[model samples]
Target: MVVFNAPFDITLINAELRRHDLGSLEERLGAETAPVIDPLVLDHSLDRYRRGKRTLSAMTSVYGVTLQEDAHTAQVDVSMMLGVLQEMAVRYPRIAGVDDGALHQFQVEEHRKWADNFGSWLASKGRVDDISRAWPQE
Candidate 1:
C-alpha cells in the first residue's frame, strides 16, 4: 500500500478502529500489515537538495502534479502523493529500481538518523532528553 506518511496514518487508523471496536485492516487481512510505500520518505531521499516546505501541496507543486481537488482529504492526498512518486521515479530511476526489502531497510535507517539528530538537537535545547528510535511503527 501507498501512503504519504505511513506511521501517522496507520497510528490514527488503528486508534479509530480500537475506539469503534472494529478490527484493524491488519486483523481483517490476517497479516501484520502490508508493505507500505511512503512517498514522503521517498521524496526526501530523492531530492535532498530542495529547500522550503515538504508538505504534500508543496511536493505536488514541485513535481508538477495536479490534484483533482484540494488536499487534506485522504483521497486527494494519496492521489497527489502517488503522482509525486511517479514523477520522482521518472526523474530518479534508481529509486524505483530498488527492491522493496532494500527500500524498506533504507527508509528505516534514514528515519532513525533523522530521529536521532532531532533528539540530539532537542536535548541541546532542553526540549527532550530522549526520543523513541522507532520507525514505520512504534
Candidate 2:
C-alpha cells in the first residue's frame, strides 16, 4: 500500500483519486478513522512546502471527499489502487491499454495532468527532488 502524500487543493486530489478510480476519499460520510486526507502539508502556515498536502487536498475536493481533519492519513488498498489505475487507462485514449507509454503516439508531459508526473518530470530534469518540491506557492 503506497501512502500517497499529495499537496493541497481539492481538484487535484480528486483527479488523482479519479485517475485511479478511488471512490470518495472517505467511504463513510462522517467517519473519523477513514483514511482520506492525504498525509501532506495542508494549511500553508502548517507546511511551507505545501507539496503532498496540497496535492492530496486537491484530489479530495475534485471527488467531493471529506475526511476528518484530525485524521490526516489514509491507507490505500492495493486492489483498489489497481482499479483506479485501470480506470485511468480509459480516461485518455492516447494512453489506453499502454502502461509504460510505449504504445502512445505522443508524449504525456503536462504538469497539470497529475501532480506526481509533474514532479517526476521535474526530477528527471533535475529541477526538483520529488513531488514535495513541486508544491505551488500561496
TM-score of each: 0.84, 0.25
lDDT tens readout by residue for model 2, 14-43: 567667887444442443222222223212
Model 1 C-alpha lDDT per residue in residues 6-98, reported as the tens digit of each score: 777777887888789987868867886646777777776677667988888888888889955668887787778889989988888887898
Quality of model 2 by C-alpha lDDT: 0.38
Model 2 CA deviation exceeding 4 Å by range: 1-76, 99-108, 112-138
Model 1: which ten-residue window has the lowest total lDDT?
129-138
For residue 43, model 1's alpha carbon misses the true position, in angstroms, by 2.3
